[model samples]
Target: MQIEGSVAFVTGANRGLGRAFVQALQSRGATKVYAGVRNPDRLTLSGVVPMRFDLTEPASIAAAAQHCRDVTLLINNAALGKVNVGALDTAFIDLSREMFETNFYGTVRSCQAFAPAIVGNRPSAIMNVLSDATWFARPMVSAYSATKSAAWSYTNALRVELRETDTQVVGLHVGFIDTDMARDIDAVKSSPDFVAHVALDGLARGDEEVLADEQSRLVKRTLSTEDGYYLDPPPLV
Candidate 1:
């Protein structure tokens, strides 16, 4: 779980939180970092190597896993986040499936492909970027929340499954991040750098789940309450 001298592969590392994760790894003294993105040409980051990885494509993920076989830290930061899309709308099923493809299935695929390597590496870590939405329902971005919820479930299961190994699985849950994905939202958002640092620190300390922000911590704390956030959720739209 130590960041120093580690080898990492971060999905969706072109911009936003993914980019932040790559930069954070570099600053934390990771020996090597692979920035996984669909188009390698778009990766202008200085320190990390650009990797051709498309989450929706099984072959692309397999190739990246093969290439980055030495990766000790796998950060599942790539996700399809769609806002202002109603869950019951006509385009609901299509968009929902697309999000599921990348956010749920893609994440699981990446984990499966790299798990063997991670187990071999030992003292490694897998950080799954989740959201506070995993604990609550927002009608505006219901599908996105659904995908995060599924990821959160998978992360927990993966953690339990890897309990005996030296490979630590940490789930990072946070509120809106100050990235392009939440640009149109009118609310205070956590900077990507801050969230990335929090996640890295959590991994260093061997935390199973990281609530990176106040909103995430509060939401998680109240999940067991009778009148939890999910009971009467915000009209995010």
Candidate 2:
């Protein structure tokens, strides 16, 4: 669907990749952009409406969907990546559960809550900000990868379910983004603005899946190889 004049709603719009998404939408001529954040007061972007939204809270998501009924585009950019995800030891269960709540479950909640509005507004779309980790596993981020894997699969299913409607479903895969989420990670990273623009471009082009960076592209290309990148993947950097 065309982004110009589209009404878009983005979750976790307070900062990082979510902030980039909001900016890109504005530059692309979106008529109205809703920034979904737990604390609307923290939003600094002007001319954009802010709504209280917390992925872990079903009530907040439902309320945002009800209030932002004009939203023709839904961008699931909110996620929990850093906290407790780098370890899978004694506290693995707790850490993994928390990440899943905000990553997988939260995204699913956003999709479910906003489907009615998106469908009613035909010519709409849903873009889920996914990760390259969906296809590989790393010890430090195994739990995190698991969450993204679940989300990635769900995105595919969602696309199939929405095939008959005018609403499009797209999944964006990328390596570490140069955002606060990867503030300390010592690895090559894609610029948030760059990835955000690529994602919007893919959405406009009606692509069901978009690889935002070379690392992601390479990783996907090796998925079917004899060694299979997942078995012992090369360094993304």
Candidate 3:
């Protein structure tokens, strides 16, 4: 779990939290980083190599796997959301399939392709980026919530499956961050750099999960609360 001299592959590294992850890894003394993105030409990391990948594409994932076979640390960070948001909106429902394709299966496929490499480099780590919404449903972004929840389930299942392997699986759950993705939201957001630091630190310390913010901790605590929790449904148009 030591970051020093480690080789890492981070998807969606063009911007947002993914970029922060790359920076954090490098700052922690990572020897190499394959910064995966849909468009690698735009990537500007000095010490990091730009890796072309579209998580939704099997061919791309395979190629990335082949290229980054030496990776010891893997970060599943790529995701997609609808171009627009609204209540009972046809746009969201219409894009539900697309959203799940990237948010859920995309991560799943990436994991499948990279797991062997991680196993080869026993005692490595895989950090799955999740969300506080995995614990509580949210309206407007109901589709995204569903996909994140599926990822949360997958992370738990993978943790059990990889229990005997050298690969350490860590799930990262956090509230909204001040990323381009959440730019429209008015809620208080954590910085991507802070989230990345906490996540990597947790992994090195062998923590099972990284609760990146107060909101994430609050939501996770409620999962076992005796009192029933309430969540509102998606708003109707």
Best by TM-score: 1
lDDT computed for candidate 3: 0.86
> Which runs in model 3 stand beyond 4 Å of their true positions?
83-92, 226-237
**Model 2, 129-213: lDDT tens per residue?**
8999999987778888889999999999999999899789999999999988898788998888999999999999999999999
What lDDT does candidate 1 reach at residue 68?
A: 90
Ranking by TM-score: 1, 2, 3
What residue runs in model 2 are displaced by over 4 Å at the alpha carbon?
83-88, 234-237
TM-score of model 3 relative to the true fold?
0.93
Query: 122 in model 1: Cα distance from truth in Å?
Result: 0.7
Query: What clash count does candidate 3 reach?
Result: 1
Residue-level error in angstroms, candidate 3, position 30: 0.7
Candidate 2 vs candidate 3: the lDDT winner is: 2
Off by over 4 Å in 1: none
Rank the models by lDDT, top first: 1, 2, 3
Give one digit per residue, the lDDT tens place, for model 3 in 1-237: 888988999999989999999999999999999999999888887788998999889999999999888999999988875444544767776677888899899989999999999989878988899988777655567788878999999999999999799689999999889999988777879999999999999988988799999988877776776752325423323
Candidate 2 residue 78 Cα shift, in angstroms, is 0.4
